[model samples]
Target: MAACGLDFGTSNTTLGRWQDGAPRLLRLEGGHVTIPSAIFFAPGREAVIGRAAMSAYVEGVPGRLMRSLKSVLGSSLLEETTPVGRERVRFRDVIGRYLAGVKARAEAEAGKSFDTVVHGRPVHFIDDDPEGDRKAEDALRGIAESIGFRHVSFQYEPIAAALDYEQGIAREELALIADIGGGTSDFSIVRLSPERHSRADRAGDILANDGVRIGGTDFDRMLSLGTVMPLLGLGSPMRRGDLAVPNAYFHDLATWSSINRLYNSKTLREIEETRRDASRPELLGRLHAVVEGERGHSLAMEVEGAKIATSERGGARLDLGWIEGGLAAEIDRDGLVRHTGDLARRIAERIGRCLGQAGVGADAIDALFLTGGSTGLPHVRAALTTCLPQARVAEGDTFGSVGTGLTLEAARRAA
Candidate 1:
């Protein structure tokens, strides 16, 4: 039976197999190795995944767009039902169907069926909750097995990145691996060398592994809440009482996982009731329009795009005219720093805990290997590199490293 490695990440997914004596990622989406972790279901019809899903939603197709799928792993939302078009489906099945589609694409690309798989997982699915973490892993394992894998295993994401990094190293070195992705920021301190590359047992090489549930999506949420949500009457005062509008609806609307939760009739009625007392009914009306029209994901995509633009060019203009004519916002490097400073610090703090767990000083690390899409953020990268100034920075194939590394693990297990 064939084996492969699956990195079903929060923002993107990649599947890889050991081929021609090296780990190679399968082209799952039209010659692309990485596919956005998204799916769209249109009423009673079949579902489309990856970029097609995003495009269908953008093209005004009537469907439910589900993104940031990994965030539901440890949360109650995993088993909870959400409206997918005209039908209600559990998040678990939605995830399973997405994985199944990805597996089929990989098998078709490689011309081989895979039965055993190694999956990449964050060190902690939910921070500081051991039982929740275990439950999340168990749920993922069940999902993988349910999809068709006869045997399943998991490797910590950062460690998998480390393994991928180890392949090019010539001599022994203590390296720190930072995997800052869509849903979690995971870290690892590992000893890597050419000699260890062929070793089947790598338990002793991984000195420490730690993670926090903060990532690119969290950054996007913070940006949306701070900059975009207020325009939707998030903190506007009410006409009846001294209290401002309750923040729950806006919070859910800003968050990717919970956005769908606000589309129900109960939420619409509650929003209508809230609008009656709202001092600015026009803003509440916009909120009503967003939820009623299911435009939350579109707004989120705008925020994410702005975040990327701001990171790349130091400034970005958010055109929200589609929601309300002439409505817009601007975000720059300074605003990103102001809004996401706390999250960046928390990510840096994880690195400290990782070092302490390894019982090594920061200066002892020879290389700082960075992977995952979030690490491209300037401030987040600064926060980590500043903490380990002596270490040389090495960038991995941000979205592919973990899957490639996991394929190595799968190969080892098969052998």
Candidate 2:
């Protein structure tokens, strides 16, 4: 039986295998190694995953589109069910189905069944909630078991990236691995050397691990609240004259994992009632149109696009013609800095905690290994580098490093 490595991320998923002593990530969808962690349950058609799912949703398909499935793991919503077409599906089953899709694809590509697999997960599924964290991993483990994997194991996403980075090093070095994914930002301090690459026992190599439950989706939420939510009456005054339009609806709309909740009849009715009491009825009218059209995810994608664009340019403009005619908003880099400053600081603080836990100084680190898609953002990269100014920054395959590294681990464990 062949064993493969799976990096099941919040935003994307990748599977890799060891081929002739080299780790190679399998192309899961149309020559792309990384598949968007998205699913669409069409009303009268088969469910779609990855790029096709995103495309189908954007093309106005009638269905429930779900992204950021991993974010629900440690939350109360994990135990709840939501309407996904004609049926109500448990959040756990939704995740299991997604993982099952990944497993089936890998088997088809490899032309063999995989009984043993290694999966990568964040260091902390839920910060400061030990029971929630344990339950989250247990939930994932159960999902893997149900998906036909007889033997399953787990690896920290950041450590997996570190192992992949370590394979190319010429000499021993103390490296900091910063992995900022869609749902979490994790850090690991490890001692790596080419000489140690062949060793099966790497427990001594890893010094410390630290993480916070914040990542790209959180950034998207902040950006949405700061820029897009206002246009939807998020801060508009109600007829009560003293109270503002309820923020919960806008918050749910901005959150990837909770956006689907806004589609229910109760939420829509509440929005309508709020609109009647809203001082700015026109803005709430636009909000009603969005909720009625089930376009929360579309709005979120627009904000995410703006966030990505700001990384390269000074600013980006969002076209919201779906909500209102000729409506646009400009999001600047400085605004991103202001909206995400607290998150960046929290990430930096986690790095400090990792260094302290490892009993290492910032100057003692030889290199900083950056991986995960979220690290591509300028603000995220700056946050970690600013804390460890002495270490040379090295970026691995931003999206594929963890999957490749997990492939190495799977090969070792199988041997």
Candidate 3:
């Protein structure tokens, strides 16, 4: 039985296979191992995935662009439909189609079909909602089986990352895996070594697992609201004097998962109404331009870029040319901290709880392994380090670790 590991992340996806006594990730898109978890339904054409989708949307192709598809899981919206082209498409089907594409590409790359797979999932799909979390997993499992996977199993994303890191270490160590992805931050404390690799059962090796719903997308939203949304009358006073411009519209625009909500006729009419009642009509007009132009995704992309850029430089420039010509915003590191500080603190507290659950002191941990795209942010690193100052920090393939680890697990299970 041939098996593979699939990391169906909110921001990106990767498929991996066990080969040559090691885990190997397949090239899913034009020799790229990672595919942007995005889809575009262009007019009169087939849906496209990854970079092609982003390009089509950015090129002004007439159709619907969907990103952050994973965020819909465990939410009521997962059962709903959205307008795409001339038809309404179910969100679950959208996810199924995307996963099917990944499966096809993986089979082509591996020269074989994979019936069994170990899929990576967050520790908690929905925070403080057990029913929703269960539904999310069930939904994912249903999607996987529907797409021809006969033997489907699950692995925590952070645990998968830990497994990948364990492969490179020669000695046993108490390791903490911090996986900060686009939609969640998950933590796992595990005992790992070369000796543990041969064991088929790792239930006893895992000490504790914890996670929070906060992630990169949340940071992007915070940054967007703090800097860009205000420019479009998010907090400006309405003509009624006592009331401020409605924030729901700006919040949806700032959030990748909710951006599509701003494209409807009702939302447009509401925006017009708000514009009429807005004391700063110019700002509301800018907001109208954004929603009317269907540029919410483009704007979110710009904000995401600025967030990533702020990690390296003192500040980053966001070009909002779609909103208005010569319109832009600058975001600094301090601003990033100000907007996301509470999130970082919460993440740090979660790490503390993980440690507490494992019955281990922070000093007892041997290493802190950081993976996932969001872990690259300096503020996130600082937050984690604050929790475990004595432990050495090691960075894994931010995007590939979980998939690679899943492949390793798949091979173990198949054997």
TM-scores for all candidates? 0.99, 0.99, 0.99
Could you give candidate 1's per-residue lDDT for residues 136-245 as a string of tens digits?
Answer: 99999999999999999999999999999998888999999999999999999999999988888889988999999999999999999999999999889999869999
Overall lDDT per candidate, in order of appearance: 0.94, 0.91, 0.93
Poorest lDDT segment (10 consecutive residues) of candidate 2: 372-381
Tell me which of candidates 1 and 2 scores higher on lDDT: 1
Which candidate leads the pack in lDDT?
1
User: How many collisions between residues are there in candidate 2?
Assistant: 0
lDDT of 3 by residue, 279-394 (tens): 99999999998899899998899999999999878689988776788989989999999998898888888888998999999999999999988887888899999899999899
Candidate 1 global lDDT = 0.94
Ranking by lDDT: 1, 3, 2
Which sections of candidate 2 miss by over 4 Å? none
Model 3 misplaced regions, further than 4 Å: none
lDDT value, candidate 2, whole model: 0.91
**Residue lDDT tens for model 2, 210-314:** 999999999999999999999889899998859999899899999999999889888889889989989999999988999999999999999999999987787
Give the count of colliding residue pairs in each prediction.
0, 0, 0
